[model samples]
Target: MATTNQNGGNRRPRGGRIRAGSSRRAQSEQTELHLLRTATWLFSERGFHGTGIRDIADAAGVAVSAMYYYASSKDELLEAVMRRTLDVLVSSGEETLRDVADPAERLAAVIASHVAFHARNPRAAKVADHEFHALTGQVRQDILQQRDAYETVWSSILSAGVHDGTFKDRGTVARLALLQMTTGVAHWYRPHGELKIPQLCERFAEMGLALMGASREGRALEACDVNLPDTQLLLRRAELTIEPREKPTGL
Candidate 1:
């Protein structure tokens, strides 16, 4: 006998896709996300090897084989999380590169975008930065490539600024360090707490510029420094809005 639903029609079992877009992938995606979240908690609480697939399946209320349906292994799940993460970061920075041509402006936008994302999703940030090493073979290489591409974008801008005399930085080392510094925001950012995003961004921007040897002026004169022309030492940032992040396409 066919199993009938409340409407008296025979109902398909779980994971069924049918006409009228009735079985949306959205549910599947949500289930996958749920599984990821549960696994993340487990992995964080217990080491990845310490946590078993059965544990994740039990926590997610899915069968062990069902877990394999979405994620081949815990490592694969981590890669998915990391890939989405890097994609967002790289894409956001790319968008930040579009409008503003100044290296200083580009740098600020990158920092701001990075800070916002990490502050907003610290868990994802933590996992991406730390747990990524847990993946091996090709998955590790893929994550590394994405990360390297992201660094290259920032490096290019910083190098351009140095060449044009807009920014005075040591080299890729310091520039990369500056980029990594923003991740600290992930360690202690609380959304509904004391500081808001805009305020934090401003403070971070000032700190980063200051580190590059830029000084803050008094209230009246200070406003002008934000627009200072590109010299061997200064950058005007008041008008420093970046263009949207875009990817390169074929000619």
Candidate 2:
């Protein structure tokens, strides 16, 4: 009961109905994405407590009643944003580490990726870092588990480097310190400033290596290729846009 359409695809009975269904699904997806992007920006600018469901719906240009179709509550939206940020971080970190053999090189690559991500998507990074305690119950636990998984990646790399005599055995202390140092980049990095992402990556990688006591062997890390996704492309993929805000005075 199917016939070939112009594109050689099978056309079934009630094809108009099928097309309409598909269109509605696509529109629904677009609306949810718009809500998520708007929520991410709002939550980043105003703390989660300060941003309400109505705020997100209004900013997304959706009726307040329609938001419940996508998310049960504002907490659900925050959880979605947090999960999305972690998913990107974990997947990107894993991809970056693939085929990178040397311990120092691995550490450098991670530092590069971390610094680049924070610098490029500062708003999302800020939300991920600052809004942890805002989530409650199982949602908070789930986010914590995800966060630990990402931290384990760094800890494993540091452990390997230390075992191989490339880095100091500072253990958990080193891992926490390195993450704090790199994540802080999201707070002050300016796109129009003198430091390009690549240079910033290199600088951060060098600092990370030094922090791990690999300074003597870190010369090679400085030259390691720091490949990362383009910032604009990443923002586009996430359906998010970040407008420039007034720069804070002083360092």
* Per-residue lDDT of candidate 1, residues 10-93 (tens digit): 643321222222476677656666766666566655657787888878877788987766665676666666666676667666
TM-score of 2: 0.79
* Candidate 1, pairs of clashing residues: 94-245, 95-244, 95-245, 99-243, 226-236, 226-237, 226-238, 227-236, 228-236
TM-score for each model: 0.73, 0.79
Give the 10-residue window scoring lowest on summed lDDT in candidate 2: 242-251
Stretches off by above 4 angstroms in model 2 are 1-21, 215-251
Clashes of 1: 9
